[model samples]
Target: MIEISGKKILVTGGDGFIGSHLVEQLVDAGAIVTALSQYNSFNNWGWLEHTACLEKINIVSGDIRDPHFCRVITKDQDIIFHLAALIAIPYSYIAPQSYVETNITGTLNICQAALENGCDRIIHTSTSEVYGSAQYVPIDEKHPLQPQSPYSASKIGADAIAMSYYNSFGLPLTIVRPFNTYGPRQSARAVIPTIITQIASGRKQIDLGDTSPTRDFTYVSDTCNGFTRIAQSLNTIGKTINLGSNFEISVHDVFHLVAKLMQADVELFTDPVRIRPVRSEVVRLWSNNSLVKSLTGFEPVVSFEEGLQQTIDWFLQPHQLTRYKPGIYNV
Candidate 1:
């Protein structure tokens, strides 16, 4: 393992769900962490605001869409983790321009900043959504990309831009493509949180979209470890690696699982507004994590049921559970 004892690192979306967990882990690894929280009037730092590592991190509030801010934040950093982007699929359909500006252009800004500053490495994040629906089981790194929605298209564009930097200019970088990650601090926008919150709120009926789409879910800590492990290895530079649990479960089954965990008898009510467009919906996503394992010796440590129980425990906390309106559809 490459030692991160005193290295300075920048995380673009450090205040987000997965990013917050990664920041905590990096701090525990003894890195001098700098986190960028999207600028807001109320000075809200998202999930990072409540963390014990808040004081240990150098927090910068800025927009990644702004090239100047990107350059400023990336300067003198040993490494950068570019996790900032617009990710909601339904919102992407209504505001593709926003997605393009943030996901694609924001990545370009970060890459250019990295090049100018001579950063040692960059861990660029990617999503399995780029694969659309899985054409084959255990989708590997070589699986063809199919952008079924504007959100996935923007991610593909961002990945292409980041890879181009590595190919054309020799910018040291790794694209960490994490399949659906779920854990504590996840917002209501995600299915797991949505289900847990509704059931915990004593809702007999739950609102959800299509029930058949399956996804390979990785725990948040495992996904964060994937980022750090890839960044530590020079072999991962200029390559895209997948981080996943290497298994699959349908949304319907997930609902039953959550309901069982909560001991709540809830019925899933299909919400028309919750479903994606027919062609835009990704029916299945299964990850083949051979490349990540071979390259970094990283494997998911949490089981599906264990991770689900942990997530449910977090949401069951009074303050956390009261933060959302479980009666309403998030998107």
Candidate 2:
């Protein structure tokens, strides 16, 4: 097992929801961390700007699509957590090419850079969406890959690119596929945030897409813990593992639960604009996380209700709540 403390670590997409949280955990673990936020003219670092440990680590603004930039940032890093990807399923419908560029080619850039730099470990993020609607319940790592949407297809391609690096070049790489991870700082594009934000914004009617689909929701911290644990274990190298709570809940159920926890008397309605294309929708996702548990002895500690309540508490904060425009259907 590798010690994270005092190691030079680089987190691509550290400015995002999961990436920001992982950055905090890495800092707390004593790693000398460098976080990469997508280059923007405004110099905004996304959610990382609000992180408590923001000042503790180095923040570089650049696009992972640029191989030179990825190479520059990856140099001298002991571990690379590649979380940067174009992940919104809805957006992928409108811009499939962007997903390919960022998710597929961007992953190529990171893996190539990591290989050349000789990084000790590379943790590539994957999503359950790659498993599509799940031909079987409790989907295991061996579950067949079904690209239901351009987003999932790009992720599938990205996962393959990362794994190929391991297979062909012997790069120390692990694919950590996480189920639906939601919590504070999640974008309103996601269901949980959409529900909580709309209700918190005082809307009586909440808008959502299909509610019948079920997902295995792992809290943000648990997912981050899985990433860190997988990175530490040499046994996990070249392996693809699922990080999930091993519990599944429907979107409708999640909406009602969040409404109850937030003490909001709200009704949910299907917004036409929010629904995915019929064939592109992934109707079910339940994860079998035995591999991660057996390898790292890590199990998600947060209960669904408990995690929802905590998320609600965070969103209720005026400073945080104001950041969201709940009335708009975030595509």
Candidate 3:
């Protein structure tokens, strides 16, 4: 692997929660970073609006679903971090076709463009949700892919698309599958933000979906590090790696932790509208990230309590808190 200091890097979905943080890290590491912000008439840069390194990056506004746009942004880049997708689970149920077009077709565009442009490496992002409920604790790369929702199904297809390019065309590629990531700038659509935003809004009764499900949460910074670490390792090429803290916590416990940290007395209320269909809900997920450890010596350094406190502090900020509508279910 070459030095990232002067390398050209393109980050699709660069304005999203994890993508924004990753782009900042790339810039800080001295890489020439180009960020893809979804085109909007307002020209807002999503989460990148609050990024300190905004002036240091080249921001392009375009949809990933556009192959011509993907090809245009993908050219003259040493590396591409493909993270664009329709990620909300509930939204996936309502509009799976959109997920397929964005996640699956978008990945196809990126991979094809990377191959044509001679990009050295493509770091494709994956989610732990691809494994659905834990058939076994600490899910590994070899674990069965149980697409419990359209979102996961779309991701599964995307991962396959990326890997196929590597297998057939020998395009350098690696899939970095990070578990549930939470931190500052994460949209209210995610559960962690939902919980934090609701509590911060002075809601006496927290509205949540299924509380029984557990997830492996990784801090955004740690996940970004995982991507960079994986990208730099040649051995990770043409492979799928998982990024996660081995620890797991239930959604109810998450609410409890946040409420305790906020010093707010709140009762949890289950909202029927928020719940997923019986078969769609992933009951549990704990990642076996030993593969990434062996390959890149990467492990999640942030503890759950510490990360949650940091996230809560971020959402509690006046400017940040105002962006979220805590009174409504974001999904």
Candidate 4:
């Protein structure tokens, strides 16, 4: 097992929901961490600004689209967790080129940088969206790639680029494909956050798209843990592993569950604008997590109900709730 302590780690997109949580956990485990936030005039670090360990790690603001910049920051790092990407499905419909440049080209840049720097490992992030509507139950690592949305198409390309580096250039890399993950600090663009924020913001009627599509939702902490475990295992090198709960739940069910947990009586109404094109909608996703478990002996500890309640508790906080504008369709 590779010890996490004292290892220099670089997390691209460390300012994002999962990346910020991963940065915090790596710091707790004694890793020297550098978090990359997207460059902006205001110099904000996104969710990383709210973390307790913010003072302990270095924060770099830059875009992964630039190869020169990628090389500069990846230097001296022992491992690179490439979590940066353009992930919104709705936004991708309007601006697919942005997704390609950031997700596909950006991954190519990271892989090249890691190779030049001789990093020990690279855990490239992948989403379950690449699987599209599952053809069978318990989608495994070998599940066929079907890109129903532009965002998923870009990710499929990104995963291929990362894997090609491992296969052709011998760069030690693992693709950590996580199913839908939810928790505190998640963007309101996601369903769980949208539901929680709307109710917390005093909306009696919740606007939603098609809610019948089911997903295998893993909590953010478990997803981060999976990333670390994948890094520690030598067997995971050059492998594509999945991080998921192997459980499935639909958006309609999740809405009712969150409403019950928050003690709010709400009505859900389908908003035409929120609906995806019929052919683009991914109707089902249930993960087969046997690979990650066999490789690292990792199992998700948090139950779906428990995670949902925790998410509800966080969004209920007035200070946190104020940050989200539930009235606006977030995409």
Candidate 1 residue-wise lDDT at 37: 97
RMSD of 2: 0.7
The model with the greater lDDT, 3 or 4, is 4
Off by over 4 Å in 4: none
Ranking by lDDT: 4, 2, 1, 3
| Residue-wise C-alpha lDDT for candidate 3, range 118-203, written one tens digit per residue | 99999999899999999988899999999899999999999999899999999999998999899999888888898888888888
Give the Cα error of residue 80 in candidate 2, in Å.
0.2
Clashes of 1: 0
Worst window of 10 by summed lDDT in candidate 1: 322-331
TM-score for all predictions?
A: 0.99, 0.99, 0.99, 0.99
By lDDT, the best candidate is 4
- Two-way lDDT contest, 2 vs 4, winner: 4
| TM-score, prediction 1 | 0.99
> Which residue pairs show backbone clashes in model 2?
none
Clashes of each: 0, 0, 0, 0
Between prediction 1 and prediction 3, the one with superior lDDT is 1
Off by over 4 Å in 1: none
